[model samples]
Target: MMISLEYIYRYPIKGFPGERLEDARLNLAEGIVGDRKIGVGSGAMAVNQSGEWTPCQAFQRMTIRPDLTTFQVDRHDHILTLTAPSGRSETIDADTKQVEAGNPTVGDQLPVYRANGNKGYWDHPDAALSIINLSTVDAISQVIGQTIDPLRFRANIYIRAKPWSEFQWLGSQLSLGEAELDVIRPIDRCKTTSVNVKTGVADLNMPALLVRHFGHLYCGVYASVKKSGTIVPGASVKITGKSEDRIIEAAANAITAPALPDWPRPMRVSRTVEEATDIRSIWLEDPLAKTGSLSNFKAGQYIRIHNLAQTHTWRSYTVSAVDGSRLRITVKRDAGVGSQAMHSFNVGDNLTVSGPFGEATLSGKSKAHHFLTAGIGITPTVAKLRYLYAQGFVGKVRVTHVARTASELALWDDVVDAAKRLSGSSLELHLTKNVGDTVGAKLGRPDPSKLAEYAKSDKADVHICGPTTFVNSVMAALGSIDFDEEKIFLDTFSSPSVETEMRPIPASEPIRVTLQKSDITENWTPADGTLLDFAEARGVVISSNCRAGLCKSCSCKILSGSATRLVGEEGNDRRQTLVCSSIPSESIILEV
Candidate 1:
């Protein structure tokens, strides 16, 4: 069969593994018909002060039986129950709304959680349901030159169809009953995808596959449920290839054969680290490493790391260049099943390794000084720093690192040596026990402004890697200081802050405006403020996805106004942005 349906599963919990399914009906604005409809309050996830969204990490220790798939927790009335796969149901009652919602409680208060071991956390609240296409998984493997399991690209439903053999045709269309969905865009891969859910090691194969092959390893497509109904596992899937069928085939063929450097591949490891805390740098030992040209890799870019124990839980972690022929990867232990299984690994254990994904690369072309910032985020920057230094880059170079303590520095000595090797280079260290008085720490997070301070001399080219929020703050702070956004390079986490800026013209001050593609022109004022508020008034229905700037669903470009992007990118300051949540800081021309 060209496209064959084999497995259907429902993960009642978000990140935790799930029970396979024979079928599940997609329902209106919800998933699996009645799935997650009635989860117990488990205690509310309280954020600073007046309850914000719950933090998923707060409930990490809650357990669920691997065999059970259905459960419920009622907080206000204090009720909980479980439906075992055996069909045996158990129930309990307790009035714990206060506890589930994280309200003030006396003594050892814990989150009231639901069973089934699934996390309900989503990047945003409206991620009601998700689906995956097996073809994409197959395609990613071809590009990165590695075999990736379908489950690594997790989704509630896995479709089998014509495009299953094709790499990216899922963006075209598929008929499931009578439903039609516009493939909004790719579901971008994340760092979470790289963490071996089972082992917590920085595994690096799947990501290498995507970054090397497809330009980006993102394979799955996100869809708005066009038609809702039950989806059974064995049910038939029909793919109507793209009308430009040859283009479809071309794209499909490309996923497996994307161009990249031939690696003196990293050697594979033969032993596993049994301890949970050990850094499992699984290598693909090439016999020539002792005397042969070693496989060279860049920093910040990651590789897919497989669980020698469970292939399904494979992940990616940034590659750190400890030497030319060999690579290093670090792991923070996971408390879940995936990490628990990785606990069986002992050093020298082997897991498949693919890539040398080039998420971070050298653009020595810029005549600007190289400002390398390192910390937890320096994995990629370290590679870049070493790459530049080894290439005899003599231009002005400086290294700035922020660490909690001197001893916590991972590879600090190596970086110091590298900085010394460069002619006229400078290395400045920023260590903080607290953000207390450090020019950096007090801000409470990383911001581009703080980074600019490290620039010290000229506004040199910048590259940053860190937590998404830290990166976001850096990007935002950098924008405020007028740093050339484009000059800044990144291998970053996508934070939903990339948005446009709009402003109101007082009713007495009429502003001339034009909508580029729509070819609409009008004089607008504060009376017709809010770009969305103004557009809808003018019958310019700016198509929007989430309207909250988080989804990047309504990204458009600015033709005129000096847009201060909500989510700042280094080189993209001159580009347009998300209009859904933008406020006009000035008169601007926009392209939708």
Candidate 2:
């Protein structure tokens, strides 16, 4: 199979129409020439002030303002003409230093800036070229029952290849024409890809559809130029080298682990640091840096420590961060048996552990995101915030952390630093006793009215993590404002009331379940919350990382009767169910 480039494109101005080229010149250390050299920003968004690379939120983009796609731009010599869908037109002299443009929906007369660097205003900081396979676009079109235009992807180069073939090129060196390039990673699909370039309407949910049809939310690959050369549309693309672990390289962009089995292994504490007064951070890794190092968990997930010497019981703790192959868990010492055991562990101590469980995570969608936390609850949110910042998230973000005093604030530096990295992002630290930082600090508890005012108007997605009292109060506040209930995600660290589970429901009957591979059969009752729980009680191990059903690790095919999934479950096809969040409705046979 011969892979050839099908098209070449450049977006001279960000959030504007793309300019097709007959040929393009690729340079070493830089991507396509004259691509994304300028960007337009509205009054609500700030233009890059540092004369350097800034995140995409600083400029107008289709993710936020889809109406910008209604315009078609053509530059002839020194004259640039922009024509709207309604036959309205505007012209700008390229010689002029100041460029002004107006949109009917967003506002009028937005400012355009010409960035002064080779990096331009590209979303990724690496100044790389984005490539998409036309076959993958065709597959998405077939699934959605619409002919998708390849331009909707906004890639620098379009190629003719097999569907999903680009994913194999991760970490591989590719040869295109006379240029050599290194494929960085897979590009995660977002709301921008759902917009129709011609109609300016987001009629399709690209992220959800991709995750449903394919296992992951990815369609394209980003490559950094290595060797300089001129390339035409029909140039051949060849894979020059392979990646060590393509799965890990490809999944680095999304919150997913590799397709591997789960086991209890001993992880050694490589290092420990005092994060705050009573808070300590420990980095865990494989003792020999061998097989277990590949367990790349996601942010907001927790690891289960098993068989502690003192407690002799299994416990779950939030994995605060992931540094390469190491897992960092921040612990605040308390009177709990697990906390005391963990706090006593020193460097070189071994602990048996499994997991990276939980469903509460950051959804890679286009919307304002608010993280409301209290005291040590900030652990998971801070981890999520750091991951978002690294992925070049370009959306409105607000983080509110409440603590007794500044000395007790955990991961304060990480939160402040991530806020600075993300444009249009704000951090609000509330201290009941002392106000160490006056810049963004407030005294007293978080007021529900203020929380509503910040999140209600934008309909932002809110993540609340704290004690039972704090979580309930925040839930009530959002409910009082009539916020969308479905948009709120809660940390599932606490158990629900026993009375509620005991209440009778329509399909609360016992059902027979057969696990084919495990060769186990059991009768499940309402007491078993989910199929995963029932299987665990029966001594069956199903490969799982995030037990929240968001990560499709526990997805199994049904061979017989029907199964019902929970209301908010996200993954699985017609024949499959994520056992973590699904239950048997009647007698069922599972492939397992």
Query: Pick by lDDT: which candidate is best?
Result: 2
Over the full model, what C-alpha lDDT does candidate 1 score relative to the true structure?
0.47
Quote the lDDT for 164 in model 1: 25
Candidate 1 lDDT, tens digit per residue, 1-592?
5554467655443343455666666654344532332233322233222222333333321221111112222222334343433445444333222325321221134334432212234332334445566755665556446665666555666775433222233335555544433332335453335444344342553433343333333445544344566665565656653333332233223322222221212244543322122333333343233332234455566655432232334445666664545666644345654445545555554443434554444666655454445455655655667778777776777666566654445655666676777785776666655544433233222345656765535557777665566567767767777777777877653211222222323334666667777676777665553455455444454544333343343567788874333323322234666664454556678885
- Give Cα-based local distance difference scores for all models: 0.47, 0.71
User: Where is the poorest 10-residue window by lDDT in model 2?
Assistant: 494-503
> Residues 1-592, candidate 2, lDDT per residue (tens digit)?
7899999998877777888889988988687766777676645445666546655666777866787788778899756676767777766554444545544423467666666555567776663689999987887787658899888889999999866567556557889998888876566555577798888997765655554444345678878777888888999999997434543333343223233213334577899999889899999974312333335556688876754442234466788887766788888989876788889999998676545666646766848889899988888876888878878888899988888887888888887877788886888888989887656688989896679778987668888888778888998888788888878877664211111111122357688999898888888887775787677555565664334445566788999886776635323334888786678877988897
Clashing pairs in 2: none
List where candidate 2 sits over 4 angstroms from the true fold: 93-106, 242-592
